[model samples]
Target: MRALVTGAGRGIGRAVAEHLSGRGYRVALTARNEDELHKAAAACAGETLVVPADITSAVDQVFDRVEAAWGGVDVLVANAGAGSSAPVHRITDEDWSRMLELNLTAPFRCVRRAVPGMVAAGHGRIVVIASVAAKRGDPYVAAYTASKHGVLGLVRSAAAELAGAGVTVNAVCPGYVDTPMTDTTVAEVAAKTGRDPARVRATLAAKQPVGRLVSPAEVADAVWFCVGNGAVTGQGVDVSGGAVQS
Candidate 1:
């Protein structure tokens, strides 16, 4: 299989790329950081192509490069996303736009770009890394929550549209992952609330019923399940540690 993982330089994206590569898929790792992409490619157990580009604006170019090299992508993990925390009334226009651009629009563009090739080839898997916020609201992250919710909607609709084409579209929604991104969130919350960063992180982890933060590898496992299962389309598989059970 030929797989492309966006934001593959770090966090959940890197884990997903490594997991797929270990399973014998020729993977393409993409992110805005060229150096990080090279490092991620080096860690892959199988064949890898490193393509560094901002997913929001370079969706077409990324797919073009991948298709040119590997015929077409058989799996697309749209795992590139960002989150911002702000009171609903205090959220700036720029923050909201950034959240939507990264969390929702970029994944949509990737899905749109990869679909035709998948349809032509008659089989594909697309998994978007969303959040537990997509399932339920949380305070102080209005923009992030909204963007995740929107992406989940996109997943459901796309899965319905592509079900007959041998393409599966789904989402893996996780909560409080133990990633650099979560570290940033912890710092931001500590700065805002005058609390210790460790305390803030512990509080976030406690929100999950598992009493800990989710692992990047755990989220990758969910993505793999979505990719390997044909009957699981249109679902948001929660890797949130029972935080947002449906």
Candidate 2:
């Protein structure tokens, strides 16, 4: 099987890439950072193709390389995204647009490019690494929340349209993940509030009923299930350590 994972340079995307490759999939990794992408590729136990590029603009190139070698991608994990934390009053138009473009539009563009070949072959899986923000509203980070909601919308619509095409469109909604992104957020919160970084991190983790941040590998397991199971389409699996029950 051939799989293409965006944002594979780090975090949940990197974990997913490694897991899939271990399961015998030929993985293609894409990320903005060339060095990180190479590292991710090296970590894959199976064959890997490192196609470093800004996913929002270079999605096609990533697909093209995968297609050239393996005919078509069996799985496309659209995990490249950015998060921003700002109150509505503080958000600029550029910030909102950037959030939407990176978190929502980019995945749609990748799906648009990958769907045709999947439809032709009668098998494919598209998994988006959305956030728990997709399901509920948050105080700050309005743009990030909106964009994630838009991602879930895209998944539902695409899944409905591809009902009988053997293509599953789904999302993994993680919350307070123990990744670099969350660590950055913790630092930002600590810096803004005059609280110790450890305290801030613990507070964020406490939001989950499990009293801890979800691991990147846990989110990757959800992605792997979505890619492998044909019956699980149009669904958003919450890997949020019981933070999101619905």
Candidate 3:
């Protein structure tokens, strides 16, 4: 099998890429960070192609490279995204546009590129790494939440359109994950609020019923399930540790 994972340089993307590689798939890894992409490729258990480019403009290059080497992509995990905390009133146009571009538009473009081949081949899986914010809104980070909501919208619409085409589109929604992104958030919260970073981290973790932050591997497992399960499509499978139930 052949799989392509975006934002594979680190966090949940890296975990999913590594997991899929372990399952015997030749993986194409993409991210903006060249060093990080190579590091992720090196950790993969199977064959890997490191394509370092901005995902927003690099989808065609990704497809070209993957097709050139492996025929076509059998699976695509559109895991590339970014988030920020800004009140709705304070969010600038640039912030809103960037979030939408990274979290919603880029994934849709990837799906558009991959669907034709999948439709012809009669088999394909696409997973978008969304967030619990997609389901439940929170204070601040309005742009992130809106972008994630748009992701689910895309997933559902695409799934409906491709119902009989042997291509499945789904999403994995994770909550307060223990990744570098969360670490940065923790640090920022601590620095601004005059609290210990460790305490801030704990507070974030405590929001989950599991009493801890979710792991990248857990989200990766959800992605694996989405790709491997043919019966599931247009579903937002939550890996939010009971933080989201709907």
Q: Give each model a TM-score.
A: 0.99, 0.98, 0.98
Predicted candidate 3 versus true structure: per-residue lDDT over 1-246, tens digit per residue: 999999999999999999999999999999999999999999999899998889998899889988998899999999999888877999999999999999999999999999999999999999999999989889998999999999999999999999899999999999999898999999888888899999999999999999999999999999999988999999999998999998
Candidate 1 overall lDDT versus native:
0.95
lDDT by residue (tens digit), candidate 2, 1-246: 999999999999999999999999999999999899999899999899988899878888888888888888989999999899988999999999999999999999999999999999999999999999999998998999999999999999999999799999999999998888998998899989999999999999899999999999999999988988889999999999898898
Q: Which stretches of candidate 1 lie over 4 Å from their true place?
A: none
lDDT of each: 0.95, 0.93, 0.94
How many pairs collide in each candidate, listed in order? 0, 0, 0
Q: Write the residue-wise lDDT of candidate 1 on 75-166 in tens digits.
A: 99999998898889999999999999999999999999999989999999999999999999989889999999999999999999999999
Best by lDDT: 1
Estimate the TM-score for candidate 2. 0.98
In model 3, what is the error at residue 220, expressed in angstroms?
0.7
Clashing pairs in 2: none
For model 1, state the Cα shift of residue 123 in Å: 0.4
Question: Number of clashing pairs, model 1?
Answer: 0
